[model samples]
Structure formats: structure tokens, C-alpha cells
Target: MTNSTRIFLFFSFGYFVSYLYRGVNIGFSGFLIEEIGLSAADLGLLTSLYFLGFALTQIPAGAALDTWGPRKVNGVLVLVAAVGSVIFALSDTMWGLMLGRFVIGVGVAVCLGAAFQAMALTFPTHRLPMINGAVVALGGLGGAVVGTPLSLVLDVITWRTASFWLAALTVMVSLCLLFGAHDTAPLHNRKRPTMGDQLRGTWEIARTRAFWQILLFPSIVAGTFYAVQSLWVKPYLLDVNGLPGATVDGLVSLLGFAAVFGSAASGLVARRVERWGISLYHFCGLLLALFVVTEVLILLDVPLPRAFFWISYGFLGGTNALIYAVLVETFPRHTLGRVGTSFNMLVFFLIFLFQNAVGWVVELWEPISVGVYPAQAHIAAWVILLALQTTAGIWYFASKQPKKLEHL
Candidate 1:
């Protein structure tokens, strides 16, 4: 393979596993609840802990990528994730499982941020939107795999064994990164910034009005989408809609497939819209409005086709990938690593809060049946999430257009 193709595959493999690790919890949710007797609150807290770990690492991981490069930094982090996977597989108690999930989150947190940084370093500026979208589409492949394919694997083996195998696969992917991924030299020809300088640079980005404005939409939409997709949706389908396990798995798989297309399409659409003179902010706002509509439909439990609702959720949800591309394009290349991770930190932290909040909301209403919360409880959680997302959309539209870096 050409070097470009090799680099793409190597980084994409990390992202694939990053997504797989995140979505694997959905496939195991029923099993963990049944076998370990976890409450909805417990499930939400445990899964959110992964985002907690992930959020904590973002700024530091970004700094590391900027200073040490993605190959070494990501390789080491993925190893940590593999170890966490093993711990998770072996754990019988909730605490052990939570700890494992947290570490796994920390390990895989670098996958996307590092890949984006590498792409920024390697590719031309104008091409980043499409390239970034394609990378995210590859990550969606991982999400797709964990849906039906993981469900099939779980039918043949216990969740523990499946997790153990996932751990092994993570190790293999890490090794590939160590051997195959190579970072391009710094583009600006400046000396590498020290850790202190990195922090100061991050702080500069954080202080900008444009940064906060850009952050509004993605943080809310991406955070809510991830919280729902990673934990609640499968249970919601099985409990509220009363779908069979196989059918729910099929729907989730379809959601994953739709997300793959959505991720790929968002960049192309954004570029086309820009060519037509629409701002990225307005385009993103339009997409977020669509996402809110879908959430409202889901909350009302409208008597629509199940596949349409779920697939719409996944497709509209994936469009948030364009937000990352926009951020990359707006920031100075020297600070792109920090800029990407800073935004990611905000997004994941919101996801952590929202995920836990949804669980807490669900737990307020007693389950009507064993392991099944009331449908109204799920609806209540959706209402709160949707409201927050709608508010963010309004905030983005109200804010003045973000100023882009001139050097780009």
C-alpha cells in the first residue's frame, strides 16, 4: 500500500477500536443487568465513568500529541486501554467494572484527537473536512461491528469472554500504531512548545469568544447523542417498544450503518453548503434543529416506523462530525492539537454529565417490571436532553459568527 493509505489505515484502526470500546457497553447492557443485577442508575454511572476518564485526558493528550507526536503517545495510551479491557472482563463487582471502564476511556481517548492532529499535519488545509469525515466514517464501522456482530458473538460466548477478546484486539491495534503510524514534522518550523507553553496556548484558545461560540452546538448535540447511543437506546427499544432481542440488535445495527453514511456525508454537504455561501455555523444549526425534531419524536414515542426513528437518530447524530472539521479549519495549525482536544474535553465532560443525569432521571421512576424502567421515565430524560440541545442551538444562532484564523 502507498504510505498515505498505510497512515490512514493505521490511524483508522485506532479509531475503529475507540468506537468499538465505547459502543460495546450497549451490547453488554442487558447481559450486565441480568447477570450482575445492575440498576439503570448503576449502568449509567458506570458507562459515564468512561467518559469521565476520557474527558480528563483530552487536554493532556492534546499537549502530548503536539509535543511528542501521535505515534508514541497514542501507542502508549492504547496499551493502557487494553489493560483496562482485561480488568473489565475479569471484574465481577460493579466497582471493578467501573474502574476498568474508566481506564479504558483514558486509553482510547487519544484515538480521534491524535488522528485529527495527524491529518492536519499531513494533509492540505482545504482537504481536511472530507478527510476528517472519512476517518470518522471508519470509526463508525467499529460502532456497526459492535451492534449485530457483537450481539452474535455474545450469543456464542459470555460477555466476559467477548470483552477479553476485545482487549486482545486492542493490543493488536496498538501494536500496529507503534509499527506503522508516523507523524509528519511540524509544519510551521517552530521549535516544539514546552509543557508550560502548551498550557498557555490552550488557555489562549479557551479565552476566545469565538472558541466558546463554536463550542455551543457540538458540545450539546454530540454529548447527548453519545450518551443515548452508548447506553440508553437499546434498553429503551427493548423496554418501551418491547422489541425482541434480535430485532433490537437489528435496529441498533441499522443505526450504526446510518451513522457511517452520515459521518461520510456531513463533510461533503458542509463543503457544498459553504460553496453556496452559507456559513458553517448556520449549516450546523440546521442539522441540530433536525436532531431536536428527532429527539422530540423519540420522546413522544410517536407511532412511527421504528427503523425510521432510530436510523434518523443515528444519521442526524453523525453530522456532528462536521463540527470537528470546522474547529480544525478555524484554529491556527500550531494550536490545532490543543484546540481539538479542548473542544473534545468540553464535549466529553458534557456527555459524562448528561449520561449520568439521564440515568438519575430514569431511576426516579420505579421500574414497572424487572430491569425495565417506566417509559415515562425515559421520556422525561429525553425531554431534559432535548431541551438543553435546543437551547444550545439557539445560543449558537444568536452568537456572532466566529472569526477564523487568518493564516489558514
Candidate 2:
């Protein structure tokens, strides 16, 4: 295989593990609640710790990528995720699960950024929109597996055993990345920036108004998308739509399947439209707005086919990834690791908040049963999500046309 192909496959597998961990909780939530006596809030706290760990590591991980390159950085850190998965599999207590999830988050935090960094270094800039989308789509199969496939796995084995398998998979990926993937062509005559210099560059990227404008809407939207996909959607299906376990799993898998297409199409369409003078930024905004509409329709509990809104949610939701391509166009390539991770920090931190908030909101009402919450509770949380996303969308659309960042 070509070196570039090797890089894509290995790095993409790393991201697949990352995405798998993110959504694994969805498949395991019922098992956790029944096995560990977890409440909705407790489940939220545990599931979101992964995102918290992921968010916390973004800045530092970015700096490491710039200094040591993606292969070395991701290889070493993903071992931490293996350790975490072991912890999670063995733990019966809430605190133990939270710790495991957080460590896993820290371990895999670099997966997406590293993959994108390696790709950007290898592929031409014009091709990144499509390539990045393809990577996300392929990685999204991890998400797809956590749905019906995970349910089927759990039918034969326990969640703990499944987690053990996941850990082993993680370890294998780490070893392959460390041994199989070559580092980017090194900087030859240039002094590698000190950690301080790398951090300062990150700060410079952070301070740009255009950066906030470009990232704000999609960050919130992506956070909401992940929050639901990872945790609450199962409960929502159970309580709101009154769907059975088998049906819910199928729909969840359908959402995952739909998102893969959404991800693949976003870049292809964005690149295609750019020839007609449409900006990537505007295309992302349009999809995000349509995503908001999907949420509204979902909340309205419209009598339309139940699958329709979910398919729309998955499809439109995945398109937010197009923002990365937009960032590539706006920022210098040298700063991309930092810029990408900084954006990730915001997206995931918000996911951390949004996931917990959904649970906290649901907890406001009494449960209909041992673990099932009332429909009103979920609707309230869903409305709050809409309000936040819609407000961010408005700000994005209302902002002045983005100008080039002065610092870059």
C-alpha cells in the first residue's frame, strides 16, 4: 500500500476506536442501569466524562502533534485508552466507570485531530474536504456498530466482556499505529517550536474573531448531535415514542447509517458548490439550520414517519464536519493541529455539558418506571437543545461576512 493510504487507514482506525468509545455507552446504558443501579443523572455523568477528558486534552495534544507528529503522539496516548477500557470493564461502581470513561477520553482525544493532521500533511489542500469527509464516514461505522450490532453482541456476552474486547481492539490499533504508520516528513533546517511557541500559536488562533464566528454554530450543533447519539436518544425513543428495544436498536443503527452518508456528502457537495462561488461556511450554516429543523420536527412529535426525522437528524447532523474544511481554508497549515484541537475542545466540552444537562433536565420529572423518564422531561430537554442551537445559528447567520484573520 502507498504510505498515504497506510496513514489514512491506521489513523482512521484510531478515530474509529475514538468514535466507538463515544457511543458505546448508548448500547451499554441499559445494561449499566440494570447491573449497577444507575440513575439517569449518574449515567449522564459517567458517559460525559469521556468528553470531558477529550476536551481537556485537546490543547496539549495539539502541541504534542506539532512537536512529535501524529504517529508517535497518538500511539502512546491510545494505550491510556486501553487501560481505561480495562478499568471500565472491571468496575461495578459509578465512580469507577466515570474514571474509566474519562481516561479513555484522554487516550483517544487525539484520534480525529491526528488523523486530520496526517491527512493534511499528506494530501493536497483542495482534496481535504472530500478526504476528511470520507475519513469521518468510515470512522462513523464505529458508531453504526454500537447500535444494532452492539445489541446483538450483548445478547451473547455481557457488556463487561464486550468492553474487554474493545480494550483489546484498542491495544491492537495502538501497536499498529506505533509500528506501521510512518511519521510525516520531518522539518529539516527549521527549529521545532518549543512547547511555549506552540501554545502561543494556539492562543493566537483562539483570539481570532473569525475563528469564533466560524466554529460557534457548528460546535454547538455537533455537541448536540453527539449528546443525543451517544446517550439520550435511546431513552427518548423508549419514553417519547414508546418504541420497543428491538425497534429502537434498528432506528439507532439507521441513524448511524444515515450519518455516514451525510458525512460523505457534505464535503463532496461543498466542493462541488464552491465552483459556483458558494462558500463552505454558508453551506455548513445551511445544513446546520436544516438540522435544527429536524430537531424541531422531532420535538413536535410530528405524525410523519418516525424514521424520517431521525434520518434527517443523522444526515444533517453529520454535515457539521464540513467546518473543518472551512477552517483549513481560513487558517495556515502549520497551525492546523492547534486550530483543529481548539475547535474540538469547544465542541466536546459543550457535548460534556449538553449530555449532563439532558440527564439533569430529564431528572426534573418522576420516572415512569425504574429507569424510564416521563415524556415531558425529555421534551423539555429537547426544547432547551433547540433554543441553544437556534440561538447559535442566528448568531452565525447574522454575523458580518467573515474577513481573513489579521494574525495569520
Candidate 3:
């Protein structure tokens, strides 16, 4: 393979595994609840804790990636994730599972932040979008290809044993990273900025109108996306829409599959949109609005077809794919890691809060037992998530395009 192609494969493959590690916990969460006898709120708390660990690593992890390179940072962390998987596999208790999940979060946080930095560093500017898209789409394949299968595997192998094997595979990848991934030394030949200075640099950008598009949209996309995927739609369909459990599972599977396409499509769109002076934010936000509209349509008893949800997710994924590149191009490469880390810290916390908030809304509605379905409380939380996404959409359209900014 060509150097560029090799680099893409290397980073993308690592990312594929990273996504697997990140989502494996989410897949097993229901199992944790059923087998461990945890409540919905308790499950929310555990997932939130994972985000807490993920959030804590943002700035530091970013800095490490920028300065130390992905080999030292992301590669090694995947090995740590392997250990985390082992812990999770071994632990049967609630708290122990939480600890293991947290470690996995730490591994994932580093892997993603570094992957973006590396892709930016290694890939050519013009082809960046498609390459980036390929990475996301390919990486997302882990979820699409294996999410449900892995979940089913856990049924046969048990979560712990499956985790053990997954970790072993992750560690092997880590070793390959150590031996195969080469770190290009800094070309600028400049001393690295201190954390305080780096923080200030990002902070200044944060105040500018430009940074708002990058910073703000990600939160909405991540928060609402996680809120829904963490099984909000499943319960909504089962309790409110009268869909069967099998139907819900099939839809959930389709959602992950859609995400893979969304990731790739968004990357390509991001690349193309930048040429037209349109922001990826605008495209994503607009689609986010569409997704919510579909939900509202369903709520109102309109013939809100299933294609609407799938199509909307495609748009959502596309919009999200642009975020990292936006961050990469908007800042100096040296600061990419720091800003990425800081952004991720915020993103995960919001994800944690939003997911639970969705759950809270369900609980408040008072369980309405229908058929085999367990009724959740009020669904006001989903409404709120929809609202947040709408707000993001509004902000995106109101903002000036990147071309407009250049003219000024």
C-alpha cells in the first residue's frame, strides 16, 4: 500500500477497535441490568461514570497525543483498554463493573483524540475529508458489523469471557502499534507550548464566533445521539408506539448500520461542503431538525415512516463526522490535541447528562404496562433532547460560512 493508504489503514484499524471497546460496554449494559439487577437510574449512573472518566482525560490526552504522538499515547492506551476489558470480564459486582468500564472509557478517550490528530497530521489536506470519512465509516463498522452479534455472543459466552478475548485482541493491536506505527517528529522544530498557554489559545478561540460552530454543535449532536441510541427509541417504540421487542432490536441494529453510512457520508459531505462555503454544522443541524421532526410526526400520530428515522440518522452522522476536521483545520496542528481533549471532556459529560435525562423523563411518565413492554415514566426528556438539537440547528444557520469568514 502507498504510505498515505497505509497510514489510513493503520489509524483507521486502530479506531475500529477503539470504537468497539467504547461501545461494548453499552451493548452489555442491559445484560448488567438484567443479571446484576440494577435499576434504570442506576444504569444511567454507571454509564455516566464512564463518561466522567472519559471527560477527565480530554486535555491531558490531547496534549499527550500532540506532543508524544499517537504511538505513545493512543497505541499504549488501547493496551490499557485490554486490561480494562479483562477487569470488566472478571468483575460481576456493580462497582467492579463500573471501575472496569471507567478504565475502558479512559482508553477510548485517548484513542479517539489521538486518531484525529494523527489523521490530520498524516493525510493530505484535499483528500482529508474522504479519508476522514473512510476512517469513521470503517471504524463505525465495528458497531455495525459486530454490535448486535457481540451482544448475542455475550449471551452464549457471557460478558466476562467475551471481554477477556476482546481484551487479548486489543493488547495485540497495542503491540502492533508499538512496533509498526512510526511517529513523525515535529517538523516545525519549535518548543511545545505549556498547558496554560495552550489552554488560553483554545479559550480565545472559544470566545470567537468561529469556535462556537465547532464547539457548540458537537455537544448537541453527541448528547442527543447518545440519548436516543442508549435505547431511548427502543422504549419509545415499545411503550408509546406499540412495536414488538424484536422490532425494536431490529431497528436498533439498523440504527448502528445507518451510523456507519452516516459517518462516511458526512465525511464526504464535509469535504464537499467546505468547497461550497457551507459548514458541516449547517448540514448536520438541518438534518438534526429533520430527525426531530420525524419524531414529532410520530408523536402526533402522523404517518411518520421508519425511513425518516434512518435517513435522519444518516444526516446526523454526516454532520458529526465534520466536527473533528473542523477542529483540526481551525487550530494549529500543535494545539489540535489540547483543544480536542478539552472538547471531548465537555462532549462526554453532556452525553452522560443527556442520556440520563432521557431516562429521567421516561421514569416520570409513570410506567404504563402494555403487553410485554415495561412502561417508562414521562417522555419529556426526549423532547428536551430534540429541543437541544433544534437549538444547534438554529445556531448553525445563523452563523457565517467559512468562506464568508475569509472574506472578512
Candidate 4:
């Protein structure tokens, strides 16, 4: 294979493992709760800690990517994540589990950002939207693996054992990336910026009003989608619909499959849609409206077939993939790393808050049985999320047009 293809495949593998680590908890949530006696709040905090670690690493990760390149940065961090997986596999207590997950978060935190940076360096700017979509589709494949496949594996092996094997696999992937992936030539011949300069550059990106306007949609929609997909959705199906383990796995897998197609199609179609005269802002607004509708259905507990709810949620969630393309088009290549990570930091921080808050909401209600929270609690959380998304949609429609960056 060509060097570019090799790099793409290596980074894709890293992302696959990153996503698998992110969603694996959903498959094991029931087991963890039952075996460890974790309450809803405990579960939420545990899961959110992963995102917390992820968020905390973003700014530094961005600087590292710009300074050292994705190959080294991703290679080192993913190894750390591998170690976290091993810790998680060995942990029997809540604190140990939390520490493992947090480490995992920090390790895998660079997966997407590094992949995007590598692609941006290697590919033409116009083609990046499609490339990014494909990478995200690979992430969906990872999610799919952790769904039914993980469930099947769990049936045959304990969750801890599965985690152990996953850790070993992660180590292999990280080694491949370290040895096999190639990075683009440096964009500049000037001296590397000092730490203070890197921080100032990040702040410059953060301070832009246009950045905030563009950020609002993804921060709310992507954050909520991730919060549900990564932790709560499967649990909701189990507790509310009372689906069997195999059936829940099947549904979650279907959602992951749909997300794969959705992300790929969105990336492929974005340029064509722009040519057709629809602004990215309006396109995102349209998708957010659809997402809000799906949340409303979940909020009302409308007895529509389970497939419809899960599939729609997964598909609409893919709309957030386009945000990466928008950022790529809006920023200069020199600063793309920081811009990408800044966006990620906000998105994940919101996810951290949303995941924890949802758990708190659920905790307020008494469980009808062990580990089964009331449907009302879920509905309340969904409603709050839905409202926030709707508000963001309206804000997008009413806000001033985002300023164009001539650097692109």
C-alpha cells in the first residue's frame, strides 16, 4: 500500500480501539452494577470520568500534535490507554475502575484529533471532508463491535476477562501506529513555538466570536448524543423496555451500523450540498431538528417499534461528523490541531457534564428493582437535553452568519 494509505489504516485502527474503549462500558454496565453494587450516580460518575480525562488532555494533546506530529503523540498516548485497559481489567473496586477509565480516556483522547491532523497534512483540503467521514465510519465500526459482538463475548467470558483481552489488543494497535504510521512534512520552517505561544494560539482560537457561534450546535447535540450512546441508551432500553440481553445487543448494534452509514454519507454529501447552495449552518440546523424530534419520541415513550427509536438516534447523531469538516474548512492548516482539539475539549466537557447530570436526575427516583431506574427519570433527562438542542437550533438560525476565515 501507499504510505498515505498505510497511515490512514494505522490511524483508523487507533480510532477503532478508541471508540471500542468508549462504548465497551455500555455492554458491561449491567454487569458492573450487579457485580459491584454501583448505584445510578456511581455508574454515571464512573463513565463521566473517562470523558473528564479525555477533555483535560485535549489542549495539551493539540500542542503536542503541532509540535511532535500525530505519529509520536498518538503512539505514546494509545500505549497509556492500553495500560488503563489493563488496570480496568484487574480492578475490583470503584476507585480502581474509575482510575483505569480515566487513564483510558487520556490515552485514547488523541485518536480522532490525531487522525484528522494526519489526514489534513496528507490529503488535499477539498477531500478532507470525505476522508474524515470515512474515519468516523471506522469509529462506528468499533462501536458496532462493542455492541452485539462484545455482548456475545461477555456471554462466553467475564467482562473483566474481555477487558484484559481488549488491553492486549490495544497494545498491539499502539505499537503498529508507532512503527508503521507516517506523518506529513512540517508545514513551517520556523522555530517551534514555546509552550506559552501554544497556549496563546489556543486562546486566540477560543476567543473568536465566530468560533463560539459555530461551536454551540455540536457542543449540545454531539454532547448529548455521545452521553446517551456511550452509557445511558442501552440501560434505558433494558430498564424501560425490559429487552433481553441479546435483544438489547442487537438493537445497539443496529444503531452503531446506522451511524457508520450516516457518518460516511454525511461526509460524502457535504460538498455536494454546499454546491447546491445550502450553507453548513442551515444543514446542521435541519439535522438538529430531526435529532430533537427523535429525542421527543424518546421523551414521550411513544411505543413506536424499538428499532425506529434506536436507529434514528444513531443516524441523526452522525450529523455531528460534519462539524469537523466545517472546522477544517474554516481554519488554516497551521492551527488545525489546536482548533480541532479545542472543539473536542468543549464537546467532551459538555458530555462529561451531561452524563453526570443525567445520572443525578435518575438517582433522584427510586429504582423499581436492583439497577433499574424509573422511566420518568430518563424522560426528564431527555427532555432537558431536547430543550437544550432546540434552543441551539434556534440560536443557529437567528445568529449572525459565521465569519469566513481567509486562511482556508
Choose the strongest candidate by TM-score: 2
Model 3: what TM-score?
Answer: 0.87
- Give the candidate number with the greatest lDDT: 2
**Which of 3 and 4 is ahead in lDDT?**
4
Q: Could you list the CA RMSD of all candidates, in the order they appear?
A: 1.8, 1.6, 3.4, 1.7
- Residues 1-408, candidate 2: write the lDDT tens digits: 988888989988998889999999988988888989999999999999999999999988888887778888999999999999999999989989999999999999999998888888888989998889888888888878889999999999999998899999999889989999686676221346776876787888888888989999999999999999998889999999999999999889989888888999987878889888888888889999999999998998898998889999999988877888888888877777888999999999999999999999999998879889889999999899889989989999998657654356
| Deviation of model 2 at 287, angstroms | 0.8
Off by over 4 Å in 3: 145-147, 184-207, 273-281, 298-301, 368-378, 402-408
| Model 2 TM-score (2 dp) | 0.97
* Model 1: CA > 4 A from native: 187-195, 406-408
Ranking by TM-score: 2, 4, 1, 3
Error of 2 at 105 (Å): 0.3
Q: List model 3 lDDT by residue over 241-305, tens digit each.
A: 77765565666667677777777776776657667876655655665566667656655655657
Error of 1 at 149 (Å): 1.4
The 10 consecutive residues of candidate 1 with the worst lDDT sum are 181-190
- What's model 4's TM-score? 0.96
For candidate 1, lDDT tens digit of each residue in 1-408?
A: 766676677888899898998888898888888988998889999999889999999877887777777777888899999999999999999999999999999999889888887787778867777878888888878777777899898889998998888899899888888887566656453456776877787888898878888887778899998888888888788877888988988888888888888888887777788999987777877887898899888777798898998899898888887877778657877677788889888989998999999899989998887778877888888888888888878888887777777542
Q: How close to the true structure is residue 206 of candidate 4, measured as C-alpha lDDT?
A: 90
lDDT of each: 0.84, 0.89, 0.66, 0.84
